[model samples]
Target: MDAAARQAVNLNVLRRHDPAISAIVDTSSHVVVYNFDSATETWKKVGIEGTMFLFRKESLNRYGIFVMNRLSTDNHNEELNSEMEIQVMGDYVIYRTLDDKVVGLWIYEASDRARIAKELEKWVVAARQMGAQCLQQSWIQFDVFSRHLAVFIICALAEDLLQSVDTDRVPSSVSATCMLARFRPDPPVSAHWFLKV
Candidate 1:
């Protein structure tokens, strides 16, 4: 398939599965994932050492499930453990354990949190519109991935825009501090939430 067609298919696959994945793509271009061992549940030396179809397709939509699956008992062997790492230069996130069962997750930045909000709203609205109370109820318990609440401020902005903005009006200084506080290891996934797709 042509690049565009492949991209479209990749997006559709991810979107149908989950929207959170797309959010990761908005902020950065690449991420890194780390995997763990199954038997001892410690850091394993084996890793996937390859790219995932989702990353190759270049869709942001599947990031959430991609992450969830890598961290959970989904699509991967139960013994597998995963984490995400971002490679700003490489434009992809590699998910793997020390063992090197690397599964590459394409990275995106900007929309991480917003995507979560949009998907949450979309699901809520769809449920209400369709009169699916059961589904709606189920969704209520789901927690948003905590990674997205952060704001990334350019270093130049820290020196320029933040200094000029009034503390009361927006508190640019405070905002910048908050952003830095939320910053995780650029890729955002640790052994805790990182997973393979």
Candidate 2:
């Protein structure tokens, strides 16, 4: 089968699984309608308001990281509200208003886990210095995928830091206990984990 044939078959399968996928794939246009509720006759436009990036994990692993912004509404119509249209883009993601005004620009990429963690640390310190906690909070509200990625990076960085610590340099009494506590990974890392340090 040719490339086009394979894509068609894939699209068919996607549409069969969830017809909403068709709306995203069929359009070359940037505008997307989401959180549609036929019963309430309400819908939201992607990148208009209440938009956030949901990382496609499979796509992130396969093709350098990718994310799509999902628009949400408060409509209580549950049955038809399951479908949401998001425009998945690579690298840079741009947000614009209906009047063609630039609202936001997001630069996302996958990098060495430890390096990213270090960068996040710097950001936290800088935020603290600049009294930008509110700014960070706003960021937290919108970027769900990046928050998950930050958790992973933090955990990796913690593991690396713990491994590099020389037990011989520390007092013998608490060394074993410290090592044991650092290695256990259950709750993963939290957004405020850097704040504790």
Candidate 3:
């Protein structure tokens, strides 16, 4: 074969081995990444281990938000993780865990919160595509592993955001009466009611 033809064949083989899309997935509550840099343009891939913080709803509220770079899971977290957030920060600093080396200093801003949350909406599409291409069957058997995970992340954030209403902490002007009516009808249908003050 000619040199040009041989190189073309090698590139095809490499592409076949590479994934069509990359995904951030949760393999049973543990955040795992199956990123194929070759699938995307070199310039698109930042070539760094990006961080995603998965926090339990209760723990996040109780302890406040934190990123566990140490990758530890005690007996407490294993049992209860129904609601969670696969959170990526708007801006963050990467440093070695104390387990390896001391963490470095960084600056964080309040506005960064809104900027990062915008990324969650994009996960739905990426998750669906990830499930379609040739990937480990264990992940794809559900047809779209990341799709379900995407829903979970969205739901987790929604629930956490509504924690105030869930706990009856609304403004006095707005009675907790609407809060009481929540889900009295299982599987709320498409209906809207106008409140005439």
Candidate 4:
């Protein structure tokens, strides 16, 4: 099969069976985080190590909002320190201090489960030896495997809708709304609603 055909098949498989395998298979082009220096107002490239997720930019922003909310709610009274360790569960990442205090927690869907698990294990070992705190504490750089995943899914759905239409005219908003509903479903109003909202 041609490359496009193969990609279509792969995307179908991912959408149907494993939505978590969004990370780029090749590691060389993974996303890298850069640290912003408040003093100089400059962004410096931070070394990239461990597993990174390939999240749609919008999804990444949404995830950041969730993380910020968790940080505020969970660690409001706790002191921020440099001796924290990070652990990755199925879809959640947890942070704890050396004294075994939970400091932060965030939910992230992995691009590739097996690769992420392996990388998380390696990072745990490294964090144990070198500590988890960095120069800039608040910034996180996620490796985006492909920014096109969301767009591709939407476009594919749009094409299908167009093909099924009896006339040439179709409302763009209708397709957009359908796409949003398909990808992001509504959730109950609660503390964890940030993940879905």
Candidate 5:
């Protein structure tokens, strides 16, 4: 598909200076990106075949992402309430928006996937310590997460997926690359290299 003529967004573009983008759903079957027009200040969306990218600046401390884990064209409400409910069941990590959109994550495609889950859980716990613990008191407010921490979560689960998984299983380099370059605490690596592989 001609992704550009349609102005389809790439998560890796990492242009953080755009208008009010609320969320992105980079999934396997479809891509849903949400952004607000700076001039018109209206919500807009761009969808491609199987992944999505979105960008947004804060609005009234009310900016929250409203994406789940699948291909969807249903993110049409104009509310910034991004309260998410998170849960860890066994080794699975579940993330749900209060409106009931949900997705779960665990380690796969890595050797010793259980260890990856364990390590990821540690990071989740750390985020809880640093943010507002919410819902069942077991998870925390994801909106409170810094972009740095959010990038870590994406990379931690899919670190070795450089060549093994399809684009559907891989989080876009967009989510980690420029997103991290903006405020990453560690030295930046060439994410393009990974994506090219």
Candidate 6:
């Protein structure tokens, strides 16, 4: 599809001023959203294949990420409500939003990407038992705007993924990357690079 046709609503490319970051998943899918990066420019062919989870951002906030071993279900909705900003990092949950809206929360918490893989394995097994559609690696990637980091949450279950995993000890496969060039755009210019994932 054409580049312009691929973009979603909430994302205004004209608003993105960062040179290192490119696009975010303005649309939604069953698994995750996809994002593009320019700095050290990284590109993935997945976009053309119709990937569900992808996003792109201009910056990241490290302090917003929280790695917990287990998320408490006693007040599940309350936590997702109170935390405001959040993302599911493997078996853990990370917070990124400043207000209480269930939309546009750009956050990722796992800093070790490898351990996150292990945790995903566990999550998939459990999710399958519940009759949820699960995705394999290279299928889902989590884009945390606040942290500028993306976690490839492969093999996502077709259920409410945000509510499936534990919030604590979010494994260690997740990593954070900050793209600061996305904040200035008075004069529109071509981005140095564009990512497919």
Ranking by lDDT: 5, 1, 4, 2, 3, 6
Across 89-111, the per-residue lDDT of candidate 3 in tens digits comes to 33432222223322221224434
- What is candidate 4's local distance difference test score? 0.38
Write model 5 residue lDDT over 43-119, tens digit each, in one string: 35433122222223344322222233344434422222334444544434344545554444342333323443343
TM-score for every candidate vs. truth?
A: 0.23, 0.19, 0.18, 0.21, 0.23, 0.17
What is the overall TM-score of model 5 with all chains considered together? Answer: 0.23
**Residue by residue across 43-111, what tens digits does model 1's lDDT show?**
432323222332212231222323323433343221111232222224333334344554443334435
lDDT of model 1, residue 124: 35
Model 3 stretches with alpha carbons more than 4 Å out: 1-66, 69-109, 134-197
Go through the candidates in order and give the C-alpha RMSD of each one to the true structure: 22.3, 20.6, 22.7, 23.0, 25.8, 29.1
Error of 2 at 110 (Å): 57
Q: Comparing candidate 2 with candidate 5, which one achieves the higher lDDT?
A: 5
RMSD of 1: 22.3
Candidate 6: C-alpha RMSD after superposition: 29.1
In terms of lDDT, the poorest run of 10 residues in model 6 is 61-70
Model 2 lDDT on a 0 to 1 scale: 0.37
Which clashing pairs does model 2 show? none
TM-score for predicted model 1 compared with the true structure? 0.23
User: Where is model 2 more than 4 Å wrong at Cα?
Assistant: 1-145, 173-197
Q: How accurate is candidate 1 locally (lDDT)?
A: 0.38
